[model samples]
Target: MGARHEERRRQIAEALLAIIDLHGLDAVSLRDVAARAEVSLGAVQHYFRSKDEMLLFALDYISERGTERVRRSLGQGEQPPRAVLRDILAELVPADDQRRAELRIATAFTARSLVSPKLADHLRAGYDSLYDVLVLLIRHAQEADEMPAGLDPERTAAALFALAEGLGMQVLIGHRNPRTALAILDEHLDRLSTTAS
Candidate 1:
């Protein structure tokens, strides 16, 4: 019963995400989610008492998937700092249709957060998690003598996040190419190498 409840909640979340992706977050409602999920409105209500709850669930679902993808790309066991950084950073880039859609959905949710403090809190946590991972990679690099001695992991991670988010927005708005964005990232890493020495 617990597993079935979890599955149903996941389905409703998926349906909410699809609606947000297709019609924008503003168009999403409990009724729309139920209709899309092919579940009753009461079912959505049972799992989520309000539209905010549903949107928050959708945001969390999307963020969890991104985190998992980053973890997978970073691979298991031993790996170099640069390799790990590249893998984790690659998760932020929209390399294909699915990723692009995910990015779009995240962007929409983030924009909505300006008016919704609850959403802002959720995305803030997500951002902090990614920053923590990036900082870990940088600290590892420094310890391994892969990065410069004076480099501040927190600041560098924040800059990388900004670069990734800015480039992602550009990609979503048709102002940038994924290859070019990647090249920019590569150049940033090269600069870090020079600074480390």
Candidate 2:
């Protein structure tokens, strides 16, 4: 019964995501979600007491999906620290249709967070996790001599994350292509490698 309940929640979240993707976040409502999911309004209400709850669930679901994809892409291997870090950073930028949709949803949630304390907290937590991981990876690279000796891991991690986020927005706005964005990231990584030597 627990599994079944969770599955139902997942379905509802997916429906909400699709709605956000197609109609924008402003179009989301309990009735629309129920129609999209082909479930009764009461069913959606059963899983989520309000629209904010539904959107929050969808945001978390999308974040987890992206994290899992990054983890799978960086599977266990004897890869160089720099190579692993490059893959991790690359995963954050939207390079395909699926990623574009995910980015759009994330951006929408970010805007919503400005007015929703609950969502702001959730977004803060998500970013904190990402920052922690990036800091760890940067520190690991420095220790392995893959990055410059004097570079601050925390600052570098924040800059890298900001760069990725800016590039992603540019890609979404058609100001830049994925390849160009990736090239810029590669150049930064190359500079780090050069500084290490």
Candidate 3:
């Protein structure tokens, strides 16, 4: 795609994400996205054949953005094991406006994914990618003797992934205070570092 076309699609996708963040997925329509994006309905339709297409594009866009941010924070093999885990888990929390906005879409899309297999696939892809990275990180920590001997990387990664997702939901719904959620995350990381050797 040309630069102009890519920019237009990104603009539309960002608008779609904003709408989902503000009014829930049910409020999403081509007109709403176009208005939010400050583009015309014809422009939205020009890029997305339908709402699902638009949503998938937005999910992919947000996932890439979220992944990039985490990678950047973790840096290139320099961060300590505990800090790496902390950064990954902390990124899942809605600590700031951008994370809160992204969490809104993630929460809404998770519900929609229950009945939409295509959406579920995209969601699963994002989660699985993160899980794989977490597994690798845990394994590295094991090789460095940070985690306990004989600890299972995949199992631990899965648990941490589940914990992060659950923490995000709890924080988003205000069921759990953000600080408390982060405290719980830190506690878990501390446990990881001090597990019986």
Candidate 4:
């Protein structure tokens, strides 16, 4: 019963994600999501008490999916700090169909976060967690002399993260191609390497 219940919620969330992917975020309605999920409106409401609840689930679902992909990109065994950091940032950009869809949902939520306190809190926490990790990675690299000790970990992490997200947004709006965005990210990483003493 528990498994079935969880599966149903995930199913509805996936429908919501798909809707956000194809239609604008403003087009989202419980009725629309019910139609997309091939379930009754009551079914969605039963699983999620409110629209915000549904949206939160969709965010978590997609975030978990992206995390799984990132873990896979890291692969087995310990990789160099540069390799690990690069893989993490590279996965954040919309370099493939899956990532593009994920980014679409994420971008929509980012806008919606302004008015939805629940979503705003969730998004803020997620960003803070990722930022902390990035800062930690930079610190570790500096400790190992992989990155220059002169560079501040917090500032460098912010810059790299901002660059990756900006590139993802650009790709979504067609201002930049995925390949080009990734190339730019790689070039930035290379510059960091060259700066190391």
Candidate 5:
């Protein structure tokens, strides 16, 4: 029963992501998720008391995996400031189908978070953690004089995060080309470098 419960929960999470992927957050409901997962509504209720809770869980799950990826990237090879910066930044961009799906789901959840405390807290935690990574990269750049010392690490980190998320949304919505999104990022980074210097 325990294993079955666990499996049902996994299915529920997968279903939620798929629903968000297809119809966005507004279209997701416990019934929709249950139908998508091929599970009874009661089974989903057993795992998550509400759609909000399930959404939060999915968000946290995505954030945990993303953090691990960023950590692993930073741990590998050379580790030069610029190289690390680019690599870290690259992870945030939705360069592949899987990442694009995640981005789409994240956007849907964020929009739902406006009035839901459960979703808002999850969104806040994810954003804060991702922002911390950006802060670390910006500080590394500062130490190497790749970025200016006087720049506010907080603001700079926020700016970089904004660029990634904004571009991510554009890419997810099919409104922006990946190459052009990258070019936008490069141009933004170039401006930062000049300002930092």
Candidate 6:
């Protein structure tokens, strides 16, 4: 019963995402989601009592999907720490149709977060989790001598996260291409390998 309930919620969230992909978030409505999901309007309301509740659930679902994709890409500890970090960071920049759609939704929610404290908190928590993971990866790289010995893990992680996000925005806006953004990230990662002055 629990699994069925969760699956139904996921189906509703996925329908919401599809709607956002095709028509933008502004086009979303309970009736539209119900139609997309092939379910009754009451069913959507049962899972998400309000528009705010539905949007929050959609954001969380997308975030979890992204995290899971990164986990799958990283696999089981075979890759080097720096490589894992690079791959995970690269995932933030959309390189295909699916990723682009995900980015669009994320951008929408981020803008909405500016006016909604609860949404802002959710975004902050997501960033914090990413920052923590990056810091740990940097520490591991330092310990393995893959990165410079004197670099501060936390600061470096923060900078890398900022760079990736900035590059992602640039790519999304067409100010930069995906290849260029990735090359810039690679350059930054290469610099980390050199001894700090």
Ranking by TM-score: 6, 2, 3, 1, 4, 5
lDDT of 4: 0.84
Cα lDDT computed for each candidate against the true fold = 0.81, 0.84, 0.82, 0.84, 0.78, 0.87
What would the TM-scores of all predictions be? 0.87, 0.89, 0.87, 0.86, 0.75, 0.92
lDDT head-to-head 3 vs 5, winner? 3
Model 2, span 1-197: residue lDDT tens: 79988888778888888888898878788998899888899999987777678767777888778878877877776766777778878877889987888888888888888999999998999899988988998888888888887888888889889898899899988899999999999998888667743
Q: Across residues 1-197, which tens digit of lDDT does each residue of candidate 1 receive? A: 69988889888878887787788867777888899899999998987787667667776777778778866876788888867877777678786777787888788778778999988898898888878989999999889888887998889889887887787778778888888988888888889778834
Clash-forming residue pairs, model 2 = none
Candidate 4 per-residue lDDT, tens place, 1-197, comes to 69988788778888888887788677789898898888899998886666677667777888888778778878888777877788888877888887888888788788888998889999999999999989998888888878888887888899999999899899999999989999999999788866844
Residue 119 accuracy (lDDT) in model 6: 84
Backbone clash pairs for candidate 1 read: 148-196
Best by lDDT: 6
- Candidate 5, residues 99-170, lDDT tens digits: the string is 778777677677889988867876888778878878887898889988788888889889888888788788
Once superposed on the true structure, which residue ranges of model 6 sit more than 4 Å away at CA? none
Q: Against the true structure, what is every candidate's RMSD? A: 2.2, 2.1, 2.2, 2.3, 3.5, 1.7
Q: Residue 167, candidate 3: how far off, in angstroms? A: 1.1
Report residue 175 deviation for candidate 1 (angstroms): 0.4
Question: Residue by residue across 51-92, what tens digits does model 3's lDDT show?
Answer: 567767776787778778878987787887757877887889
Task: Using TM-score as the measure, name the better of candidate 3 and candidate 5.
Answer: 3
- Segments of candidate 4 deviating more than 4 angstroms: 1-6, 35-43
Of candidates 4 and 1, the better by TM-score: 1
- For this target, which candidate reaches the highest TM-score against the unseen true structure? 6
Backbone clashes counted, model 4: 0
